[model samples]
Target: MPTSKDLCNKEACDIQSCLKKNGFIPERCRKVIEALERCCEKCSYNSKHCGSMSRLLGRKDEL
Candidate 1:
């Protein structure tokens, strides 16, 4: 089974592809962003990289 960090990494990549496929319109990828947020919550058990990414995105919820 995949660890929380692994799942988060996968979700991060998914978000990247979703961004590219949706022309980087954040509004066009709400589901993907939520999914990544869920994954990041799980990732707290293993890593904080997701926190940095969330900060980079300027998402208030993540901070």
Candidate 2:
């Protein structure tokens, strides 16, 4: 299985593409993409899942 980091690192990993395909509004998904960028910038190996996990667990309602 591809880790989130590997998924994001792929040249084809367009967040907008994924969101749009999944029926998410591009505008709303932008926030998630932005957060992912911010988190990944600080992650070791630039792991994409690290950023995603941060956003997921950071959401008060989701926790």
Candidate No. with top TM-score: 1
Model 2 lDDT per residue over 1-63, tens place: 866557445322555465668685445455556555565654553675655445432452432
lDDT of each: 0.65, 0.52
Best by lDDT: 1
- The parts of candidate 1 lying over 4 Å away from their true place are 1-7, 45-49, 56-63
Runs in model 2 with CA error above 4 Å? 1-25, 48-63
TM-scores for all candidates?
0.65, 0.34
Shift in Å, residue 54, candidate 1: 0.8
**CA shift of 4, model 2, Å:** 11
Question: What root-mean-square deviation over C-alphas does model 1 reach?
Answer: 3.6
| Residue 24 lDDT in candidate 2 | 57
